[model samples]
Each structure stands twice: as C-alpha cells, then as structure tokens.
Target: MFQEKNRHLPCFAHTLDLTASDNENMKPLIEKVKKTITYFKQSVNAADELRRVQPEDKTLKLKQSLPTRWNSVFYMLERFLMLNKYVASIILSDSKAPEIMTASELEEIKEFIQILKPIESVSKELSGEKYIYHIK
Candidate 1:
C-alpha cells in the first residue's frame, strides 16, 4: 500500500483558477470593463438602449464577472468583445454611459481572450470530469 504523505497531487482546475486570477497588470483594465458592464446591468434604460441598438441577429447581453465564479472574467470579456460595436455606439451617444474602452485596451482584451481560451477549455474539461482514479 502507498502512503498518502509520500505522494503529491495538484488540482488542475485550481491551478487554472489561480492563473486566471493572478492578473495584477490587468486589474485596472478589468475594473474599467467591470464598471462599464455594471452600469449597463444596473440601469434599465441603458440596457434597453443597448438592446435597441444591437443587431437583430445578435441577442447576447453583457455579462458581469463574479469573484466566486470561475472563468467569469473570461466570459465577460468574450461577451464584451462580441458586442463591442453596439457598446461603442451606446457610449458615444449616451451622455450617461461610461467612457468607452480605448482602442489599445480593446486590442489588449482581444489578446487576453486569445491567451485564456485554451486555459479555459482545459479548466472546463478538468472540472467536468465525473470521477478520478487513484493508483493503489
């Protein structure tokens, strides 16, 4: 029999979570994006304005990231990028809307999403597993 103390195992999902969460360089950008999303989410008029401006073919709404939820930031960013055009229009026309993300920030967000996609996929797969086998 093997002693539990002699072997070490790490949680892949947890590792991924840490990697995603340890983004000090992106905190400011992320915060700005979060605030923008929060504005839309909390204001019925803003949400309605977004809906009205959005294309008929696209129905997805902005997503807010929760601290407790895994990969929420990624999802939020992904959705934000998806609706970037509509969001920009709203920000430009609405006096109450938060300032729109700069072109550099938007580009950085696209790069960030590219980097996180694979990690997110792996995390999802690891988390979705129903069982794990332990060697005896």
Candidate 2:
C-alpha cells in the first residue's frame, strides 16, 4: 500500500502492521502522534538532509536496515516508536516552562505527554518482541 502511494520514498520497511486503531485508552495519544508524524514527514528535504549530514556508516546502517530489510515488523514499529518518543519528549520539554508555550499550547502538549509516556513505556517493554496487551 505504501509502495502504491509513495513509490518515490520506497523504504519497504514500512510494510509493517503499524496502523493506528481505537483503543479505549490509547486512541487520542496515538492520534496526536499520527498528527505529529504527518507534520514531520511533510519536510522530506529535511529528513534527507538529516540523513546526509549523518555519518556515512550511520546513514548506510539506516538505509541498509530499513531500505533493505523492508519487511521487518520490529524494525518499522521500532523506528516509528523512536520518532514518536522524540517528538513527545520535545513537546514535553518545551512545555515544562510555561513561558515557552502559550497556555493552551502547554495544556495540549501536557495532555500529549501524559498520553505518550505510557505508550512509550509499553513499547520499551516490547522491544524486539510482539506485545499482547489485555485490558482489564
């Protein structure tokens, strides 16, 4: 599906089971993360620039890891989780001092942080294995 939609940015590692779905607890936070990713991905040039300035070995590793492995479920979720964690942290840190963000902005990102931390914790526990979350 990604290949059909985004052939130019064909990193086959994206074919993982990484869809956002409604969870009684996780839906809103996951939606926030999805919104952040949409904003981030809009800057294709910047992502490429990040890849370029990265050390050759690091760049090669990223390309080899994803562009080559194209079908690893662990790799895709790991990558997405990594990005989501970073964005959440940035939002959290920026919101720490009230002056850095408007009241409404701080409130929104505060909610974002609250939602994301649990998600981050669960992902950390899963690591390279599949998770089976059961709601009580």
Candidate 3:
C-alpha cells in the first residue's frame, strides 16, 4: 500500500477557503462590514429600522459571513452591496449605528465581489453532484 501521506490529497474546497481567508488587505474592511452586520443583526431596533426604511418590495437584508464557509463572504458582500443605500441611511439616522462605509470602500467591495464571484461559482459547481472530474 502507498504511504498515507503520499496518498492523501488536499481538498479543493479547503484550498478555496484558504484563498478567501488569507486576503490580508481585505481583513480590515471585512471586519468593518462584519461589525456593522453584527450590530444590525443583534439590535432589534436597528433591524426594524432598516426594514422599515427599505422598499416594501425589496425584502433583502444584510448577510454575515461564516468563518467555516468560504462562499459566505461572497454572499455577505453581495447582500451588503445590494442594501448599502438603506444601511447608509440607517447609520446616518441612528446615533448608535456603526460608521457607514466610504464611497471608495464600497467601490473596493464591488471589486472584491467581482474577484470572488468566479471563485464562489467554481466552489458551488465543485460541490454539486453533477460536476464532472476529468483527468487531463
């Protein structure tokens, strides 16, 4: 039998996780987004305020990234970007709300989302049962 070390292979999903988690430049901005999301999630009043201000047809809300899931970051950022206007309004109106993201930072998030979209799509495809693995 082959040695266990030689036979063992790293998981593609894990590698993707590493790629997302190891982005040092995004850490600070991600932390800020996380904190803002957490604050809104934890504060009933803030969440209610956000919901109240949001368009009746637009029920989408903020999303928080999960440490264990690599694609969660993409979802979180996507949802945040979608709801940015409402979030900014909340932050402006509420004294207790976290600081709003700057225009440049929001643009950075947009760019980061573009970078992550393919990674997220690939990860999902890899996880699907229909995904084909061809040995080149």
Estimate the lDDT of model 3.
0.85
> Model 3: runs farther than 4 Å from truth?
5-7, 130-136
Task: Name the best candidate (by TM-score).
Answer: 3
Rank the candidate models, highest lDDT first.
1, 3, 2
lDDT string, candidate 2, 1-136, tens digits: 3468556632221322222112345445434444544444555643454455546764521111133332232332344443433344444543331122234543554554454455554544455456444445
TM-score of each: 0.86, 0.31, 0.87
The numbered model that scores best in lDDT is: 1
List per-candidate RMSD values in Å: 3.1, 13.2, 2.3
Quantify all predictions' global Cα lDDT against the true fold. 0.86, 0.40, 0.85
lDDT tens digits by residue: candidate 1, 23-81: 99888999999999988898888789889887778677999988877788899999999
The runs of at least 3 residues in candidate 2 whose Cα sits more than 4 Å from the true structure, single-residue gaps closed, are 1-21, 52-55, 59-77, 84-136
Ranking, TM-score, top scorer first? 3, 1, 2
Query: Where is model 1 more than 4 Å wrong at Cα?
Result: 1-10, 133-136
Ranking 1 against 2 by TM-score, winner: 1
Name the weakest run of 10 consecutive residues (lDDT summed) in model 2. 12-21
Model 3: pairs clashing at backbone N, Cα or C within 3 Å: none
Per-residue lDDT value at 21 in model 1: 56
Instruction: Report the CA-based lDDT of candidate 2 relative to the real structure.
Output: 0.40
